[model samples]
Target chain A: MTETLKKFVAGLELDTRMLGMIGALVILWLSFNMFTDGRFITPRNIFNLSVQTASVAVMATGMVFVIVTRHIDLSVGSLLGLIGMLMGTLQVHILPQFLGLEHPLIWVITIVAGVAVGVIVGAAQGWVIGYLAVPSFIVTLGGLLMYRGAAWWVTTGQTVAPLDSNFRLLGGGAEGTLGEGLSWLVGIIATIAAVVMMVLSRRQKNSHGFKLKPLWAEFTLGGIVIALILGFVTVMNSYPLPKGAVRRIYEARGEEIPQFAVMHGIAIPVVIVFVIAIIMTIIARRTRFGRYVFATGGNPEAAELSGINTKLLTVKVFALMGALTAIAAVIASARLGSVGNDLGTLDELRVIAAAVIGGTALAGGIGTIYGALLGALIMQSLQSGMAMVGVDAPLQSIVVGFVLVLAVYLDIAYRRRAGQ
Target chain B: MTHANAAHPLVEMRDIHVSFGGIKAVDHVSIDVYPGEVVGLLGHNGAGKSTLIKVLSGAYKRDAGEIFINGEKVEIHNPRDARAHNIETIYQTLALADNLDAASNLFLGREITNPLGFVNDDAMEAETRKIMGKLNPNFKKFADPVSALSGGQRQSVAIARAVYFDARILIMDEPTAALGPHETQMVADLIKQLKKAGIGIFLISHDIHDVLDLCDRASVMKNGKLVGTVNVDDVTDDDLLSMIILGKKPGEETITS
Candidate 1:
């Protein structure tokens, strides 16, 4: 590579794994777009894809920390199921009996109850793994079965349904999307925030008496970020709804078709994903806790000798995983407008696959939250694209499995070349 | 070159004994290191030098012994307790987080933080650069993880971490074992600087040249038992060798203890 190209890549401050993940995502999107005859890249499909990718992406962020710590949580999917059932019970049955369905308190109480249950469950499992010295794989594997069985027992294999309107809104139903104008404003604010963060970090690096990246490089990065954010907002703002829905009111009054704004912008789940991703990235990059996590993962004995409480860090990572799983449970159940005994079945594998595809090593000590998010998006895109192309469901699974293995194999090869 | 009077020993290990599965790995060994002194611990592999030092560094719980730091009895149940008393150990393995950058590894368990409780990476990198400037001026690759670093550079990072933490007592296990000649000289310069600052160091080594050149005193162990500690100027290299091989000190006749 040329010196300038090397400088540009270095100045971006992204490791090769992140760049690889992004490259793979772009290629996947383009290939899917071709397969779907341009439909995969359409605004509506993209918006729906973003919504579909949110839950797995959220859990994948937490899974990065878990897997980085050289552990796994096989129970997240079943845990999501159990938590979703609890959320259903709280919102659909139990809460209405005490507080009226329309009362705003019901929402707050149900959400809190769901999250609290997740935390307690997660922490208990973590404690068993950390303090009791049980291997994490066996413990969580047991939890997988227990939580799944409990989800079924909670309603005797019955489905819980008809969640409140506010809950459904959180899942990106018609009422859940931000309008175009608000989305544009949000886009601008986010761009400004990105630029400000960049400037502040560069200044901080300068103050640290280190070599600074060239100003042109920084400006180029800032420009790309702003363009991407604005472009995304533009796409989301232009999703054309069905003509029938737009003209129904006019047709009812025997009138001409009126220009109608589409029912789309940024869905609540997408916003949730973005916010969670940002927070998780910061925690993984900027916090002392994050450093300890990486250290423990890289060399546990070294970390312990350095005086870090690796056991507590393990518990905390798992608890965070559980908490995110709960959030995923809420969004998933809300999206379907009901909770089933089999809710979130097989989701744990998907989340783990996403993290691995994003360059998180099973051997531990390396991963990025954004990479995992993009990994989740890539998988979602492939699924949605294949479905649109009329591929069989079983064939889709085989392809995804092969892609996952290929991604990991390529990552290992890249690392070997880099001599990691 | 010795301040042998009045200044108390920085750390004193008395009759320390540690066992594994009913076998004495470190037999009743007593050692003391004074401030501004470099005590070379010479022994063969599995001669118990590492285990003996591990007792003081709290890497192992002594089956029988007492440890005193600065003339006060201190109980060290773990590495944290050793760190609490400013005792730092650099294992032969270097014990660095390989996936972390030099700054992150330098400040690994104890990171400098901003008011928001976030690890101040900039401040850490700055401090790391400043310290490396003092210890090893040629170290410039702060952005790369320590795993990508050369052996000499990795050794420099480990040395810098212990030195930066203001460790009053330092234990180095075969620090130069994996290093090149130039890097070994760099470490010698570091030991001199640290010595001038009154930091006591226990230098464990199998290299007689390193021990003779860098240490003020030499103590040899055989089969988990201390043979004797001799002033470098008072004993020839042959005498140290005899003490190590035969577990018998020079000028001793009909004496076995």
Candidate 2:
């Protein structure tokens, strides 16, 4: 037990950002419950918070890459709005006749179109920054205004609403009883596959004459991850929308079991956010491209002298950021069942702040996708919990702004101390 | 002193003149190096010994001069041209990125890539180890970044890089400036190894002891002008210092002698 305690402390120390964020989260939760008379801790509120945070967190993952390169994308919010508008326009005007596509296929086409637009815009900005040697602040600042104007022009300053039911299913719909069971099965299989991969990688490293972490370290980390997943499943099962709640649909249908029975199972948006987080983490940690990103951030001149095409790497990072912004835009539009010129207004600051708070250095060379996700969660929770406590929207914004400043100050202090 | 082709100089610079911002940094200087020879370039802080080597390394464009490599006039306008002409310079700053490993520094700006278009780490490591073995076998920095390496080890890596790329003419600026006695010896041994390989070296230094110990010929400069090149065997440290300080050969001028 003493050894286990020591190991846990060591792990927590290794993950300073996560531990700090978790502490902040706990504090925020307590304050929220105290102010809301415990309503903030309700299952319904938690589910709503998760849904709302997903879009920003997804966007924040990409923002981390840009920030790590010591660059800023002030235009992410405007770009997201523009992409969302474009997606809505495609669905309304182009999807049915131009492609002869049905519901789900049309959604896919819309997403692809959005992402393509994002990539083009990102590439254009990246080219200017990388080749022309324009400051990212100026380039992305120009992008902010330009894309916002384009979004307004595309949508005619109006909201596009009444999306197809299939499209709505992506954001608002929950899994059916059978679907929940299937998701649980898929989740278990994925966990197993991940474990196998980790074991294989460890073995490969061992064979290659590299030092492997102690078996206990590896097993403890793996076990904790599995435990978290199981805990999540347990919480989901206990919710009112559990698979067991699907009996209500059968009762209404006057049948022993309803064929279309649905519970308030995990929403697609939640699943999407989780999957995107996982994939982004993998991409950041496991790929050569990811290593290049870190290397470029660490010392661009050194990287260049090492024969790394830093210009291309910068362009690729921005392009990836754009693609992620588009994905976030789609999710936001789907959740709202509409798209508007104001869809992502001021979200850029929030995402950047989240990344910063999560320990992404303003000076570049240090950051992680997981840190950005946690940062987004902290920001989103503040907003959601404040709302539950009857705080006005503008006040909530002020609070979030103050927290962002505090987080940045804390980060600076930590960095200085670490240096000493 | 008795090496083969010692009569035929490997590199000859005639009336080399270089200026920076209208100031004559190297004015009417000439020097030569024979195969397997170490030519020490001596000067005060601004006496233009470095400027002359910069011209040779193609880091600076000479205003008026001609450089002959093996009796053929060569125009070197850039580092690439210098490399093509087998001229390599190891500056006082070393020019090795500290964050990179020895292998990466060895292949910086020209990495060997694999068939899949990624840097060939194994090949680079093998080449680095092999070359380092010849230069400084005691240098145990195989994978560690150059930043962590000692001054002598860093110099070893820089020298290995130049030699590995087939540099026939090597220019070293203050190679042992900051090194201790042992480290300086390590570099001196490496320089001897280079001479044995038939690579002509330009050893730039202010240390007369180093010049006497390592150089086959000592060339002193004063106020952007060549004093004279003397066989190291024939000159003393005080003679070289007099040439540097008084702007005249030690015995050739009555005032100095």
Candidate 3:
């Protein structure tokens, strides 16, 4: 039976560690659902959880690269706060003076400026850590303090409110959804992409005369993926828009409200997370830059000797981290409909925890984008689950900390036993 | 050796000097390698042999020197520059990215990529299989990271990397130090094969037997300075050892060939 189970897992090409993590997530969700008397597993709660996880999840994907290269970015939270404040000011105070109120370009210009500043700041920190030969810990820790102070200085400790309506859609609230039809369209397209990718990869392997997984296994894996994707779409599509939101949407469109309740399909921020995950996965698995990143992390001396410009690569990785943090800032501040000094405060810890819990080793040279996404989800679930069960915030944090350490410990033990 | 030397030497590191913090690690070392010849660099641990070779391999910049490739004055400021000139080095540490599979390590700097610039890992694996099949037919762990491989297997990965690139000047630093007798013999055969292909090789080894068995010439270093270069046919193991240990050349520096 054990042999058969092993074969089954191998056939499906499933990572046992990932499977274990998925199992833990399922158990956590189910237990929480019971504790909250089924409230925790509802479509509304799950949707909120996904949206809440988006900012950290987005940052976590970049953190995989940062940590896989055996570095840390403790300044991500502060960087996000700074960028968010800067973008907030641009949208409210500056862009209006230049382009008039409610101009279409205000949001676009704000986002581009935020991301640009993010990359510049990130690359600057990277330059110091790379070319200057400073330890990443010391450098980013300084950035943590510096950027936070800078963020406060941006608005002089005042909260920026009443952001542009369009910008707020990125934050994934009642108005930040794709609606039912668009969500199904995205789900269908994603499923088709997944299938095509698998078939193309299989064909490529075949051309090289490499061993292929069994046809049944391929079908089974495909089935599982399709089920998961469609299932998520269905769940999102099931959650009806609140009566007030439905009326507002119709009134804005200058149409009478429909008789049927409209579903608030996938949240926009959640879609952003999915898109980032896909792009980051492709970058990590298929690009030479990604290959070099892993190689440099694996052995700095070997990578340098192999003619890889590792110092420059460090700068690029950190720059990528900065850009991602900017995206997170967009989601975060938009979600709140305002930007404050406390925006993304302590988010560095959450992002790092998400990456570590997702199986990124601190020692470097090993991580996955999907692992981080799932890790973020798991973390959010734990916190919200405890909250639903009426646990105090302090207790929730304590439990979350224990889980993080325990998960890493368990992952280490698992890897040791697996002899990898 | 005379016939091989009749052609222009493939690599010449003239008056190479390197120092660290005022300490001369390699003081005025000059060496030349002819195509299809193996020149063994003999020295004790701190004798500057590795440092001199590192300059040629582009691991270190010379404090003062000139390097010529195929009789052309060349600049080699980095490992990429060295590789651009088809110079490959298998260091004492093997220099394999431990977390990457053998194929990834083999084609690291020069990966086989699609037109889109994405790494074609399958193509690289196929190429690695073809090469490893030739080098070590028993090597089956192409899918696992190099870290998971045994010492000899890891050695083969490093060797495969250097050889696969069609290097004109190959530097092997104690290639067989981690291998068993059988694997050592395998490397010896590989060296002979590489030599027959007209590759110029710099073999750095403390093993007198390895030098005597494989090298056509030997250059010994002591106190960051060259003792002298000698024809392997004219020197016994004792003569080479004395040159390494006592910083003295043998009785006569004659090329009988």
Best by DockQ: 3
Query: C-alpha displacement of B137 in model 1, angstroms?
Result: 1.3
Which residue segments of model 1 deviate by more than 4 Å?
A1-16, A240-259, B1-3, B252-257
Which ranges of candidate 2 are over 4 A from the true structure?
A1-8, A11-13, A30-43, A100-104, A164-179, A208-210, A237-266, A270-288, B1-257
Q: Model 1 over residues A1-420: C-alpha lDDT tens digits?
A: 699898778877757777777787788789888887888888888899988998899899999999999999999999999999988888888888888875677767878898898888998988999999999999999999999999998888999988886787778765577867889989999999999999898888877667887887788889988999999999988885567755764576698886766557888888999999999998998898889889999999899888888888888989999999999988888888899898999999999999999888999899989889888988888888899989999999999999999999999999999899
Per-model C-alpha RMSD: 3.0, 6.0, 2.1
Alpha-carbon TM-score of each model against the true structure: 0.94, 0.76, 0.98
Compute the lDDT of residue B196 as modeled in candidate 2. Answer: 92
Which DockQ-derived CAPRI band holds candidate 3?
high
**C-alpha DockQ of every model:** 0.77, 0.17, 0.86
| Model 3, C-alpha of B32: deviation from truth (Å) | 0.4
Ranked by lDDT, the better of candidates 1 and 3 is 3
- Order the candidates by TM-score, highest first: 3, 1, 2
Q: For each of the candidates, what fraction of the native contacts does it recover?
A: 0.90, 0.07, 0.90
In terms of docking quality, how is candidate 1 classified? medium
lDDT of 1 at B247: 77
List, residue by residue over B31-107, the lDDT tens digit for candidate 3: 99998899999999999999999998889999898999888999999999999999999999999889999999999
Full-model lDDT for every candidate? 0.88, 0.79, 0.93
